[model samples]
Target: MHFIEMQATARAVRAKYAQVESERYGRPWTAEEIMLGFLGDVGDLAKLVQGKAGVRPRDDLDNALAHELADCLWAVLTLADTYGVDLEAAFADTMHALTQHLDDVRRSP
Candidate 1:
């Protein structure tokens, strides 16, 4: 699926989670809570990467790494949506700047 499609799906999933949390905890997760969760996911992803690189031992390495990556992506997509960021445009602009920087550096003495 395209990035936009994936982002839409992520938002839907986030809404579902919020509903679940509200039913269980009497409140939905706040944006700060979501960001904390995202940070945890990122930490797990880093560990999975280390395991994949043989720097650490972990079980179910393949599945865990894939799951962690998906978790991270979901967090990023949802956070961007919450913050009103146009990720597609931001990504394009950032990549264009990086490409130009690399080209300029390559031409330098």
Candidate 2:
């Protein structure tokens, strides 16, 4: 699926998780809490990356890496939604700037 479709699915999952959190914690998670959770996921993703590089031991590295990547993407999509940021536009703009910088550097002495 495309980025918009993926973002929609991520938002849906975030809403479901909010419901679960509400029932369990008396309220949905704040953005700070969500960010903390994202940070934890990032830590896990780091370990998985190390495993993929043979710096750490892990079974099913391929599946674990894919899962962690998806998890990270979901968190990113969710955070962008939470913050009301236009991630797609921002990503495109960032890529354009980076590419322009690279082209300029290549033209230098």
Candidate 3:
């Protein structure tokens, strides 16, 4: 699916979580809480990365890695939506800048 579609799907999942969370806790999670959860997901991703490199032992690392990556992406999409950032444009611009720097480096020597 396209990036926009991925973002929409992420948002829907986030909304669902917020609905259930509000019912459970009397309030939905704040952006700070979401970021904290994202951090936890990142830690999990790091361990999965180590598993992939043979530094950690795990039989299900491949599947877990994919799920962790998706979790990270979902967090990013939700945060970007919360903050009113256009991630697609930001991502494209960043890639363009990096490519330009690569070109300049190639021309230096």
lDDT per model vs. reference: 0.94, 0.93, 0.96
Better of 1 and 2 by TM-score: 2
Measured by lDDT, the strongest candidate is 3
Colliding pairs, model 2: none
Minimum summed lDDT over a 10-residue window in model 1 is located at 52-61
TM values, all candidates: 0.94, 0.96, 0.95
lDDT of 1 by residue, 1-109 (tens): 9998999999999999999999999999998999999999999999988998999777799999999999999999999999999999999999999999999999999
Clash list (residue pairs), candidate 3: none
Q: Which structure is stronger by lDDT: 1 or 2?
A: 1
Residue 18, candidate 3: alpha-carbon lDDT: 92
Model 2 Cα displacement at 105 (Å)?
1.3
Please report how far candidate 2 places residue 107 from its true position, in Å. 1.3
lDDT of model 1, residue 69: 95
> Which residue pairs collide, candidate 1?
none
The prediction achieving the highest TM-score against the true structure is 2
RMSD of each: 1.0, 0.8, 0.9
